[model samples]
Target: MSECCCGEKDIYLPELATITRMQHMNETELFLHLELDSGKELGHMPGQFVEVSVAGIGEAPISNTSSPTKSGFDLVVRKIGRVTNAIHAMKEGDKLGIRGPLGHGYPLEDMKGKDLVFICGGIGLVPQRSLINYVLDKPEDFGKVAILFGAASFEQRLYQDQLARWAQNDKVQLLETIDKPHPEWSGNVGVVTTIMNQIDIDLANAISLICGPPIMYKFVIMSLEQANVSNENIFVNLERRMKCGVGKCGHCQINHHYACQSGPVFRYSDLSDIPEAI
Candidate 1:
């Protein structure tokens, strides 16, 4: 069989994967570690996603939270509807059907030699984490790296352990903010955009990337531009309901582009072409 762009031999059929480990991030969120049943490498890019299917239930486009360099890939899930609810009920050793690593990924080449900023809000950290780890694994290729995450409260934060370790690194700057007040939290308490004002960013040499709730896009983009980051240098990950990972179904289309085919990761300069891209 010929290989598709995502490195899988077949793009339409689902590959069976075994869930080997599981961890709960909060009350409603969990991360599952998976290994392909056939023992093949996923070979997914940092921003790509997989359409995960349960036996009787349907499938949903799930972002890869774990880094491509890690031993096992990760899928972060939040219960929303039927498919995700069934996925939430599954545990380690369960079987899952997957079909991707689909969609365009971040512009790693364009990111070379530039200072980096990652803005993640809520569960958006899942996809952004992939790129963050990629940069960390190859620090010599880039300049200073910074990650900023926003949560409504301390309990809503994801990747706590890694965040702590990353924050302690002098080369990797990490900052977080909470929307409302939490006296005991003792950390930044405001929207994530506010953190932009505090970091010493060299806009001339910086590239800003963001992945967050749709509502957060407008305000966040404004902040990055105000900081002098070029529209072409800023990237955003937009997750859509990609029913058919191959793009036969029209669910993931955004005007002329299909989110499942052309993107999921788009530079602000490209996003300007689609009014509904945000």
Candidate 2:
């Protein structure tokens, strides 16, 4: 019953998603906790994203940072453009237009009982955190767990609070690095690939999930290859500009496949020929 950023309303229109709480992680980044007007729990899988619209402004895709097991979800919005900036200006109780929990999520069911290695970089952790939390909730279902994460600088780190907690847990291995190290820091410095060199993985039973900027892929994949991890065992999430969350929009297409539908999450072997994809 609230106004949307977009004036248009119909089946293509979005339902109301009210901001319940807000956390300002940094200047440009904010995490919004949203509850639906339908009063039904927002059910979505890890790696899926929602199209958020500000009334009379526009809509942009934002990935879910919270676990699917929860009643509500959290969105980490980066205020880099118009629509996002409009969303950033909104406050708690503001109703934003939400289109979907679109895109195919990671196939976590297939990963059960396998040693899971998560390689995340910067804001890539947004979606990756979902899988991480799912695994943490049912740690006994999987084998050894390791998370190798990196950020540009100390201030650029995402989910610092969770990272700190992860670093302390004994059941899993957590290694983090920043490109530019500060004097107060003593942790690993350099790229996340450096963590690959130190961890001992069972190549036969372990699988690695990679998510990050395009530049991080080649190097990370190369590192995984060096470690004898098979291409089939490696999965990746590819990002594309999506206008429509469904396959009807050509914006997210990569050759024959649609990143919004067929992927966003894919086995590396499935993308062996997609050059643009990393």
Candidate 3:
């Protein structure tokens, strides 16, 4: 096994992790809490992803949904593909192969002392939640934090209990909206960007982190630009088609950049020149 600078084993070799908890968040999403068999931490940063493998079903790249500061790790898997479907069939005590904590994560060190704005849509909130909780865990390490979350409907929302708790935290300002009004919903009704105006932060200086559908990026960037947030201050998590977390495969290549290696999380300014990136 290859060794990293910290003397950890190769990232390509899958490690055994047992599911400590499993819950269905919605119709398609499954939340899993895992602990390594070696009794060691996953040592993952906020936006990093792991390659989860089922016995004969192969592996898929999944973003870590829990913060590094937290024990073990978490993942929210969407049942959209074969590998993910196999993962969904797993039980609380089942073991799976984990091959990462891969790729670059969000720049938390740079974000220190800066006002933060997190814009998340649908299941995209899964990855962004890691950083959100990281910041919230140490409120004194950062400035003001505002979270703007948008879901398709009341049934599509993830982490309902956690969202309510975040809303109650004095360190955070949380605003949630649905795409359309439902009989059971009385919250704001509109697209995620529609509620961007409700965020009260120093737009020009605050660092904005966005994660969601591909379509949401264009419009959300536009909204941030309109508010005068510079591209340098805006980071986006682009967890695209990353087949190999080590970047040997070209599946996640965008122009000269590889999402699996150079990204998955990048400053908007660094990706501005790459038309295929956004």
| Model 1 CA deviation exceeding 4 Å by range | 1-10
Q: Model 2 over residues 1-278: C-alpha lDDT tens digits?
A: 97777976553578998999998888778989999999987788988888888878888878888888777999999889999898888899999989888888888888988988989988888888888887887888878888888988888888888888887877678878888889877988998887777765665469899998879989989988987888999989888887787888699888888988887888999889987676
Q: Each model's TM-score?
A: 0.94, 0.93, 0.96
Model 1 / residue 67 / CA error / Å: 1.5
Between candidates 1 and 2, which one is better according to TM-score?
1
* TM-score of candidate 1 versus the correct structure, residues matched by position: 0.94
* Collision count for each candidate, in order: 0, 4, 0
What tens digits encode model 1's per-residue C-alpha lDDT throughout 1-278?
Answer: 65466874555678899999988889878889999998888999899999999878888899988779887699999988888889889889999998878888888898888888888999998898888888888888888888889997878888899899888877787888999887679888899998888776675468888899998988999988787777888888987878897778899888878898888998889878798888
Clashing pairs in 3: none
Candidate 2, clashing residue pairs? 4-55, 5-54, 5-55, 5-56
Higher-scoring candidate on lDDT, 1 or 2: 1
The per-model lDDT (C-alpha) reads: 0.86, 0.85, 0.92
lDDT of 3 by residue, 42-83 (tens): 999999999999979988999999999899999999999999
Cα RMSD to the true fold for all candidates = 3.5, 3.8, 2.9
Which one is best on TM-score? 3
